[model samples]
Structure formats: structure tokens, C-alpha cells
Target: MHKKTMTFRCLLLAALLCPLASVAQQAPATADIRDLASSPRWLTTKVYIEGAPQTDVKANYPGVVGISTWDPERNRYEFFYTDTGKSKYDNGGGGYFFITGDHKTHVLVPDVGPTKTMVRRLETLNQCEFTYSREVPRDMVENNPLVRIHVVHAPYTGTVETLSALKPGTPATP
Candidate 1:
């Protein structure tokens, strides 16, 4: 494996496995934007679009998108990905995203069965900066290799962006 690819995977593994508990042994105090226990909740300041999705979902998921509120109680957030063309994807249009974990890390796992969704990972540094990424070999429908990555800063209000900044350097699947 190439060094860059390995490094990226290590980083992702860390993000995916970050602990969500405040009870863990304290070392340094870093802010966890995913921690929605506070009031007002986390809001999307901007969304970024990088590469492209499956041809079928391409029309719906855009380069830049807006995000909805993060509901802690429901552990879910919502967003719509539509191109200016204003066309709809053949799948299920856009569906809701369910995120798991807390504080240290928050991730959108792969969907089982029929949804055919991708795994999205989000790491919000502050109200202004955050990273959202998706690396699925075949998105929405099978055989569509889609990888999206968005490293957003102020003016940061968002959702799905295809592989630009964060896509894996190597093949995601063996």
C-alpha cells in the first residue's frame, strides 16, 4: 500500500472510532462540534461538492448543498443534493441520513439492504470549519464508483460533495 493511502485510512479509522463519552480519561480539552447536548444544536454553515457521484445520483447530489438541523434526540441530520438542472435521481430522490457516535467523532455508516447509500463522515472543528466525506465504490446503484470529499470553512453551510479534497487515493474496495 502507498504511504499516502495508508495514512488516509489511519486518519479515517481514528475519526470513525473516536469516543463519544465525556467520562473518558481527560487529556487535553478539545471541542467536539458533533456534541449536540448544548442548545441550538449544530447548523450547517456551507456545503461543498468535490468529485461526482454515480451517474444516476449525479443529477440530484450537487457540488454545493445546504444542511438542515442536527437532531440529537433523533441522531439524524438532513440535506438535499440537487443540481441546478433541477432534475431528480432515479433512486429514492434524497433520503434522511442517520449519524451515530458523539462528541469526538460522528459518522454516517453504510446502509444495508435496499437503501444503497454511502458512508459519510463528518468532523466539525468549529462553527466555521468542518470536513464531510463519502467513499463508496458503487453509490446509490451498484457499479457506480463515487467518492466525495469536502473540507469547508467559514460560509460553511452544507452537504454532499464528490471527491476533490478527501477522496481515498487508492481503490476503496479490494
Candidate 2:
């Protein structure tokens, strides 16, 4: 009968389209940095030392770097730098570094999951005249205080002697 044929055709079409709909629904809604660069909303800002001329250094997602100012009032490290670089939809994670007069440490905060790692490759970029350091809050570095430095985009990096070591803020003796 024509009615039977019509019903069968309609059912077949629905079955074929169902999988396509599901696949499209499963695709991630958010875009990556490469995609963001193409959008008109994408904006980048540079951070500068109070007295030094701004440098080419930039703070991209998962790449925030700065120095830890001693907060006498709070008795804690006050991070003074630029933005956190998180997306509007989700809070993108990053790393941090703590640079003291003698040493540097690295910390990684992942966007997802429960694991945190610390790194120790605190090398100075002599050519760029920049130093790097890192630290993890006591809560993050509890069980495993030692962070592995095998990956890129760790959470934090710090430097000694403030931004003065790099330029106009102060004379670079070293």
C-alpha cells in the first residue's frame, strides 16, 4: 500500500538523520586560541614595570608571568601583573612562578582534573634580560611538592629583583 511505503520511508529518513544530529551535538562548543585570534573580540594587552619601558613579553592563555610583590600588610605574596586569560565560557587554568633573591620555582594549574605539578627549570633568559620563578599554594603542592617540568604552559613564573633587572626601572648591574 502507498501508506505503508510512505511510513517506511519516513522511518528510514529519521533513523539516518538521528546519528548526524547526535554527532553534531557532541562537538565541543568552545574554540581554541587559534580560533580566537580570528574573531574581532580577540584582544591582547601588554604589562609593563612601573618605570621601565614595556617589553615584547606577552601573557597569553596559560602563559602568565610576573614578579611576587611582598605584601607587608597581608604577609603574603601579592601577584601584580596582567590578566588571568580565562575564556568567557570556562575558567582556563594557568601556572605561576615564585622567584626569590636566590631561586626560582614553577607551578602548573590545569584547566580540568585534580592533578597539579611543580617544575624546576628556572633558567634566566640572559639575552632577553628576564628571570623566571614559580610557586604553588600550600593546598596545591601538598602530596607532591615537586613539579615535573616536561610540559609547556606551566601556571606561574617569577623573577628576582623585580622588573628593574630588565630595564628602565633600575640600572642592570648583573
Candidate 3:
């Protein structure tokens, strides 16, 4: 039993460390996940491959806005967006995301289907602007080195203005 337990522990440690080892060898990314993760302002304006459309989100949603509000309790970023490409915009939504050990260079975005994980790496994050590039399987050929996403901050609206006037703990009207 002792031998079996020791073997199991070794396997578990290897399972964790190998993935992180690769991330550690990589260079630092300019964008801090902390900055993008906390703000409610990110609006996904375009998702493309150099000049071509790359994802369905771009095809379906004309003004595809993404919003993230910091969840102080969870310690993870929650993604919100205009639902399924129908875009009256900013109805307040939620989503899931995962990050790697380095907290830079790599980001795991939940894909549209089960068992499929879309991997995005940081390209550029200039102030409120952000760009992430996706990785596709090697069997697929492409001119673009990256499948990219572009985002800029959502402009403050009347709702935002009203919310600003509220006291710290006060909730804005629905």
C-alpha cells in the first residue's frame, strides 16, 4: 500500500509540473491578465485571421461586446457578452475562462463545443485595447501565425453614468 501511494503521488506531481514547465520557459507577455480580468469595459470588436473572418462570433454578432466584472469573492474573471449574436448590447451576461501557471502568454478560453478548448495567447494589450491569438491544430494550414481577437473598452452609457452616482454599496435600477 505504501509503495502504491508513493507511486500515485509521484504521478500526480508529474501531471501538474510538466505543463507548467513549458509555460515557464516562455517569455513574459505584455498584457497582465489581472488588468483585463477585472474591468467591465472590454468589448470584443473583431475576431479575424489577418484579413479573413476566423470565428462564428464575428459572423453572427455585428457588435459583439464582451464585459468582465471582477468577482472579489471567486478570485476568477467572469465573462459577459451580447447573447448569441443578437445585439441590442449590454444586457449583462456571464461566461467562463481559465489561465495558465505563468498568468501571461497563455489563456484558455472555453470553446463553443464540449471537449474542445480554444487556446489564446496574448498579442498586445494597449491600455483598454486587447488582442489574443488562437492556436489551431497543425494539420490545418494557415498564412496567419495567429487567429486574433480585438477588443476596446465599451464607452460609458447612461446606465453607467447613473451607476456612478450610486453610493458604494447601492445597486443600480434594473
For model 2, state the Cα shift of residue 53 in Å.
17
Q: Across residues 3-119, which tens digit of lDDT does each residue of candidate 1 receive?
A: 345445644665555543344322223545444334232233333344432223433434334323334454433333322222122232232233433434344322122333344
Clashes of each: 17, 15, 0
| Stronger candidate by lDDT (1 vs 2) | 1
Shift in Å, residue 69, candidate 3 = 4.1
Per-candidate TM vs. native? 0.37, 0.21, 0.42
What are the per-residue Cα lDDT tens digits for candidate 3 across 1-174? 643454355445544644654633232554455555444445566655434545434553333245434322333333443443221212222223434445434332221223222344545554555565544422234563433343334322223311112223433212
Q: Provide the lDDT at 128 for model 1.
A: 44
Q: Evaluate model 2: give its TM-score.
A: 0.21
| Model 3 worst lDDT run, 10 consecutive residues | 86-95
Write out the backbone clash pairs for model 3: none
* Stretches of candidate 2 exceeding 4 Å from the true structure: 1-67, 70-75, 81-117, 125-130, 133-174
Which candidate's TM-score is highest?
Answer: 3
Top lDDT model: 3
Higher-ranked by lDDT: 1 or 3? 3
Ranking 2 against 3 by TM-score, winner: 3
